[model samples]
Target chain A: MDIKNILISVDASDNAMRAVDYAASILANAEGVRVTLLYIERAPNRDKFDDEAAWLNQCKLDHDRVFDFLKTARQKLVAAGLPEASVHERTVLCSAEPSIAQTILDVQQAEGFGTLVVGRRGLTKGEEFLFGSVSSKLVHNAKNCAVWVVQ
Target chain B: MPESVRELVERFKPPVSVRTYGTVFTDTTEFMNIGYGDVIKLGGRYYLVLGDERERRFGMEDPKFWVKRCVEMESGQYRILKLEFQESFDQHIGSLTITCHRSAAKEARILRLVAGDMRFMQGLGVRDERGNLARVLERVAGRRLDLNIEDLHQSHREYFQETFPGILQRFIGACRAIHHLHQHGETHGDIRRDHLYVDHKTGEYCWIDFDYGYDSVENPFGLDLFGLGNILSFITGKGVHTIQDVDAEALGITEADCALFFRHRVVNLRKLFPYIPADLNNVLMHYSAQSEVFYESVPELLADLEPCLENLRRA
Candidate 1:
């Protein structure tokens, strides 16, 4: 119940947005709760057809989009009465690593968040295997934080 | 005549013929011969199992086993049974005497009316109806469909190939059914393949069995979602080896003995038939992903599945 730091990872999908809403709701109740919005950049060369330069440019565009998404998410939290200073944003530039699960785990540990909120789907696995999600890696690899996957 | 056995038999009308065997009696009704007294076979169709008289006196229950035999009756054959008593010396063998009667067509009809009511069929349809659908689902690529987790190992190698194509659509239907249940504030506690019935004509899936179901504010969608994922692994014969292989592990119990059990569970659908399609793989994956998000309820999962189903249909 003593939630000190909360980490919300977003992929800009509707599901991820739901996670943001959930994080905001939890943060809304806790006193002095700090929220960190993190987005891991998808690696290049994963798309079979895209060339290196094209992938890099797309990554930049994706970065800007992430920034915009975080900005909007932060404002929504503020409007919902969370202190603006308590909210922070960070982005890691990594190749579209199949190890997003590992990256999420690493970030959660490094930041020492009590709770980690994530969308049901992100960069982990494809859409087909949605329910019995392969998202286990993220939950399994997390050291101490309780991971809440927003569907 | 022992008072107990005589009284037990008197509870029902006298059989056309009664014969004693080891510890049972055979009672012949008009159309069928029921084995009563002990355990007997009458006209090869009915079996009456008796309880020990001592056990009955002590308020212990009798053995309750009813055997129904399918036989062709001749026009003039009278029902007859051969009975046996467990202890020949005991005057009153058991507290309960089982009367076996050949159920006449009229009796069978009455029983059907009482037992085969729509509600009962619906209940049975919910539990065992999946078998009927599994039979109709065409075998894909010379491989059979493993309908449950018990069939994993024997069907594993061909699982991925057999499930990829048709899986998405099946998932869409499942999601829809789950969504409907959630909307009504009900949770399908058991979402196993055996609980699902696939329409033979339309390939549409219907969820059967409302028994053990729950309706609560804290909906355990995750549990049901995981059950769905478990079914996918079962149907695909992958057998849920790792979290990567299954969605049920999302509950956070990673190194427990239960996890190990999941890893070794075996189901063998391929051995039965060899033509299951490969399209079901996609469906398995879709359901697995949805399982992760089950806490959000079934409607959200169905929304995610709708487009996936459309894509599969287009393909």
Candidate 2:
């Protein structure tokens, strides 16, 4: 019941920023509370023109973008009064083999975080039907850890 | 057995025991409250008795004026009639009444063409002398489908698939009705999925609402066709639900992407549904296309749609 560790999944989206803001507001001055910002690089599916080099280049670009997003998120938390020492950043390249959702859950289990903070990109009913969302998957799958999905 | 005149007359008189007709509309939350009306039955036929005495001093000048005018000007079965509430104080508190006619398949076709009953609720609409309005809708004896498109798509997906041929037929029927409007030098300016109605029993489609319609416009039927495109996409996609729900960011459909549509760069529906028929996707693309390269006339659109519908029906 004690708030100790919080893992937030960051993306280059307003919703992701909103999640960070939510975590910062709730855990701003809480004693011993630590924040881990996790950025997952979902492996891009290859098309006809996309060779190994092109795929790697795209990954590198995505990594840099996500890295920058993570840095901004950390700065936001520190500014909100959480100690810089309490904030941590983690990144991983999730191959399509395990699925993006499974990768997220795997990391959550390994780290043993108490709470997972994730942003919900509002998908349409049709979109949701075709592709089940990551936040939804985590909430349903992660039974032990508390998952807060900020829209 | 039909009721006698004496029985019908007695039914309309005093105690106002018309409760068994349909139901008194106490819940006006979902209803359009222009005036109060009781859905009553007489002589085995249904009638709506709409009453307003608020403007009695001013000659009860609303539906009474329009009803009187319509009776004088238009011939045949008058949709409005003067209801005498003998016990009521006012000498001339008139009720606009409409007789409900059971529309057969043949009648539904003619109704769609002549009545413009597609957009509005199927009913007899009466406006006051000052142009205020009230409607006495026909009692639909058959099942009424869900009002919202989202619910219809979600709940009736199987129905749509099973009766897709018939659905396509109705789609063409709507297009034909639009064609009729265009032929008369009129335009249904605001054409959307909401304006189109489908009869659950008859599978008939009607176009309603001419509030935004006009006798003539600068653009020759293009906007209506564009609206038809929107309707087609709505049917194919089941329903998009809301504009905000659109994957605008993912589909690159922002203001920057607006130019792509204008440049004849088509957005495939198959991208949303990979197994979607190519013919159906092509029809969708053609309708959603900005240029006249696809269709300039309703007939042209129909020409394309008929074959597509046939092919889809066969498939």
Candidate 3:
């Protein structure tokens, strides 16, 4: 009931961003709610990159974009009245070959978040179909938390 | 034209196939066969009455009663009157009468009754085609398990003890869900054990059976709050006494004064479930008390639950 810790998975799409906006609005009124912004990047192929160095550089760039987006989102939350201290951000290199849904579920369980908020649509068409336009799969699969899909 | 004929007409058995989808009659649409009889499909969707002497006798009058009873049972919708037999009845040996209550047919057509509504009749184990009562299918799966708080303590003790934290967390979440629903102007009127389905696979609990649920914001929280508290009490072996006994004890009042102390005397989760961790207990107590104070809304209680959950996780 007390949604102190919120886990929102964003993919930088307009819809995903809108979902983040909705989540911020819902939690903004609370006195001390902590929001964790998670962005997952599909890991580039080790074979595609000539060597580990190339892969590392590409990963760094991907992390930068994720961080930059989080930075922008963090500002939005603060602008919406959330304390800067209460907001946390993270980006992970999710190996493209593995299922993203499985990864999200693992992260959610590990994090022990009270609520999981996701956009109805994500970045890729495949992602949209697999996770649904609004992450309906998460709602059906996730345990112990309420899944909110913002239109 | 004798006394027996008059008597037979006056006391004719209630139309046995009254509510049934199809009835058989003569070319003139006069009654041919009736009550608790098997409906034999004559062709594609058409059916005929096929039962022995008892069913034939029942068919004589039961259909009329069935239509009348259904009208009386569900008053709001339209009524179904016995429809006159059509030319189709001429082909059959015994004329097949197609009787229908107009209002009842309209109600069924408009309302789109779910199987659950007819489950009671199904439970009675009456199946003679025309699709048995909804209850029959449900009962066929097996009668529902009646779970009391004692069962939670005994059979599910390990599951409860191991997953107490999650249970408390979900309970708080349920409170929040109810709170949200209230804000949207809805109240889940019945919060009994039967209405709540706990998925053993995921430890998630969902509220179902909304037949009597109300879509009003006013006092929705109390509808489930008291029931939830009592369930918790029952689970912890607090005894199956009336709400007065448990509520009075929790509130520290005598039975005679329970009416006055009713809402105020509700027990906190920590007090009721002593084995809960101190921090978690604090959170439970905070929301439990808040539920009493804001028995009308869930927002405040949810706000309290949020922080307590975080603090418990940290501890």
Candidate 4:
């Protein structure tokens, strides 16, 4: 198989955009390399929050955050010399994955992306263990794909 | 035809066969009992068995009498010498009969594979003079997690809320470690309370002892998952809650609205401790005797545990 696709995990944080820019910069002039902007809409479920309203608000926040980053992530990819035809965006449901990192890996594998690009959230090891960071999990578990964790 | 009379008649009967000649009988086995100062020669090195204070009082009559603490005569470094011990048993879960047996070879295989990996018991498998493969393990100086938390003063509710989350974190880490081991194509096989130790040096729960195996065609690691479930049940309730002991504990708990596990025990912990999060209890229910479906893999178990753990952490 001629593996030529790069999957970038899109997040609302500035660091996630850093990952986008990193992938964009690397594959800017590289031929036959396609880019995918993947965003997992992560939010607390109704049962997780004290009230349904709180859960709805979180859902809205996650929805808006994905859109907020998707726009910039796409423009930056195109601005970095990747064609509009070659760029793809995927917004996956949070419930689809056990963890966000696992979801990204599952999507990457399902889509046959050879390289998975993610951003380092620069969280302390303890914090990462408790809260979990996608970049670290990807670095540890992303098999059959190359993971680039950009700081 | 009474069983007592039949047994009495059999006791008076002589041996079925007697040695007719001086020729040595080749059909018998004489197990050499190893003890303190006993030297076992494995590979090219000799190991002198040693003992701590515990051995002095309790002796080596423990089930794992074959395992001994030793020091390499050449290196002077401490190591655990695991001699082959034939241990096997069967567990009845519904219509299923899970056959568990000891596998020194599997332990040695995993030890060598995960050497220098802190999550697993580290060791090397060496062929002994008897041609049986033995394990020479790097001694991990740590208190077993179960024993460390055995005498806690906190009430079940307090312990469950205050300290369990921390212990659960370590347990989760250990499970993840087991998951990683599974990824490397091996199951811990024996996930027991004593097997998990809180390394005093690193403050991490390190798994030890992997010589156990079972036959489950559907899931090779299913027994391992069951072992993990048993450990979870033990830790969550602060002790094994079998059918026989619930009365002794005097918790005034009833079997109504409860689920029993192996040996008709564990009367639905959610009922006993109502404060236990439903989600967490639901995970435990997978191991209940009444569970229609069971956890097939460690990753599947982890997927269920993550959310409950996150909720607990936040709470």
Candidate 5:
């Protein structure tokens, strides 16, 4: 049923790998289950600073690192028993959206992905209070899409 | 909680039990005599209560009777010390009856919930050792919307054409901020023109007093939406257009064509000014005496406001 393609977001973090592991465990034998590893190369918010060159350099390094994580996630999914031909990698170079969760959903909607998977990063209430909890934002705002959150 | 005047007075019992570090002024003859240079210990920290802030341009500022302007003894930064003031009110619009409250404890809980939200007044819900809950908010540098409007010395038609559209856009921003608070399962219990502050530095319409709220099981945000409606009407009419000020000779309509509150405040704007678009006027009329259908929520109010904003922008 329209749940053929599942998009799993990877960020080179241990929690993101857990999401990859969960996806791998589910698609061991499910035929025609296409898995896409999504890496969002988010632009860092530079609020007070005006240094253009340093910011661009940092963004490039961050993009390359996330792109490497995308390949690693794809390999993990294939090695865990999914078909090598079915798993694909996608990297989106995105500006800072209102929230990262919104960017993930926007890409999912545009590419016709049926299912969305995200990893709930381990952040304390104090940290989440300062910076928002992305996985929580996704869980609340995701509509017309089945979301599998790996805590 | 207060059903009588005595109970209401008891609710706002002044903090006269503070064991001052030094006897600065012992003139305790005046009624409720606590004034400038007074030191009170809260949460083991001392604060020096300041006099009513004055402005050379506008004379003495609006004295916040509920809260006092104080300076933290250690930091020297100004802060708003929220005092124990509990109040509630009831208002009716047509068939809808709304009850609102001024709850200090409820505001403390809400401040904790919306601690990280920038749209709200930044503060900490502090308590003393013996368990007296209070709040110490940052002394924000901003202009209250009420005073901001009072400073605008333009005619109603001139303001409506030139500056009102931009202000309406900002008002929409405030409405969205209210929606954010509602999303977190909290209501800005009191929505007043003075409660909405425009930060001088950020230009963001930050909502200040959240200590006021309602517990309408039928419509939780009904009073809030009505409060927002009143603000909208106030801004549109340049000020509160009492029924006495409006006339058939000046505006081409009488009391029969207009909707007035129980206190005889004019609600209907089409009778006063026919130039107001029907789409926008309809939303304003939703809180009138003749209003059969009412705005149930903030989002419902926003749905009508957004299009009206777009239409105004286009025109």
Candidate 6:
């Protein structure tokens, strides 16, 4: 598959770093491919703010913090042989509008990303039972796109 | 106590009840009369009802929903039970509700991490068979200090001034909370004055409504610092409430402006509040000003703010 855009979800967790490393190694020779790093955050409480203006101010803050992570991802991708300019980063705060996996699928479709990459942290059966894994959810939901679960 | 007798005894025991809270709807159009203290039962599990009129809803019936649901359930790694759209409403104009697994909320992780040092409104997550999700949050008990309401702004300013030291302490406490999140390699994503809540009597405070995502941006810390600056400005009556309140021309900006240039023009903190104290003013300007030397991290900004807070303590 000629991967035009590869969207990877990362966090501070070690699994996310593993996924980053995996993507770097796999895409080392894949020229002309663009990589996008995405991080999804929990959405803010809308009821707390009395109006849209207050909510907008909070949104600005959320968007502002993404700059640092984007820069770091760009550096890693560039060091991994991806063109610096071709690597892009974005962040989304889930307001419970859509489940996290669905949100990722929507972004993939909207942005025309050809592949989705995520880390598969081996969760204990109990851990999985309590907190559903985002990777497994993405792998099943993605249509017409490649889903990569890096362990 | 023999093995065979013990096995027989265990097998005869009643099934454990899976705890559930609230109702699950298929879409926003489903009619909902859900409220706090309501209970929902599915597959021998009972979920306590929670949410107000303004509670956020979650649901989906997309094609991929089936696939995602299957994957999530098949993994044998989740506590989410089998979900189904038990009823369909005639009209779909309103929001859809889902039964959230209590442990599904990100706040649960936060609560565990903070160990009750900071309080947050708790909630449960509701997920359906299609992998749709929603949360059931416990309402934080207190009158909301809605400073953003135009009618309340003046009154709030008076209240803030009357309790300046307390308000300042609360603001610092909030910063400390944000700093804690940063230490764990996380960002609140959305930081503002609205998220801070205080008990009317005790004056104990907590930052509510964790939102926002982390990304690889040029200045990762700039976002929160900018937010903290704006929040401090607002609490201190130094912030402009609206865009029109700002004088774009003073910054040598034009009417027709792009985002980058406009942001630069808008961050004129000195112009907005020239009389602001030098130390706090410096911190605010550096963080809020788009073109100025912004602090690279939250700790660095806190370094400057701590001294200003100490000065306040002495005064």
Predicted structure 2: clash tally: 9
Which docking band does candidate 5 fall into?
incorrect
Query: What TM-score does structure 4 among the candidates reach?
Result: 0.55
Model 5 TM: 0.56
Give the per-residue lDDT of model 4 (tens digit) for A102-151.
78888888888898888886864222322345676688788887778899
Per-residue alpha-carbon lDDT of model 5 for B120-222, expressed as tens digits? 8888877655344568788667988867887898977787778888889989989988888777766786787878888898777888877765542223455
Candidate 1 docking category?
Answer: incorrect
Per-prediction TM-score to the true structure, in the order listed = 0.33, 0.39, 0.31, 0.55, 0.56, 0.43
Highest DockQ among the candidates is held by which one?
A: 6
Please list all clashing residue pairs in model 5, or write none if there are none. Answer: B189-B212, B189-B213
Q: Candidate 2, residues B1-315: lDDT per residue as tens digits? A: 124423443344335443323343222222233232343232224334334322122234433321111111111122332221111111110121112111122122333446544423354433323332333334232222224345553444464456556667777888888887777654565676756766656667756434332211113465577668767766666654232455755754433222113322224555545555777766666643232234546898787778877776776
Give residue A35's lDDT in candidate 6 (0 to 100).
88
lDDT of 5 at B106: 66
Off by over 4 Å in 3: A1-151, B1-149, B152-161, B176-180, B200-203, B213-221, B225-292, B307-315
Which one wins on lDDT?
4
Model 2 chain B worst lDDT window (10 residues)? B85-94
What TM-score results for chain B when candidate 2 is compared with the true chain B?
Answer: 0.52
Clashing residue pairs in candidate 2, if any?
B62-B128, B62-B129, B63-B128, B118-B206, B118-B207, B118-B208, B119-B207, B119-B208, B120-B208
DockQ of each: 0.01, 0.01, 0.01, 0.01, 0.01, 0.03
- Model 1, span B93-138: residue lDDT tens: 0121212112122122222332422211121111011111000011
- TM-score of predicted chain B versus true chain B for each candidate: 0.37, 0.52, 0.41, 0.77, 0.79, 0.56
Residues A1-151, candidate 1, lDDT per residue (tens digit)?
2247888887666777888888777667668888888887654322221235765787678777777898898987887779889888887754323345666667777767888888875433222122224246567667677788877
The residue-level lDDT of candidate 1 at B78 comes to 23
* DockQ-derived CAPRI band for the predicted complex in model 6: incorrect
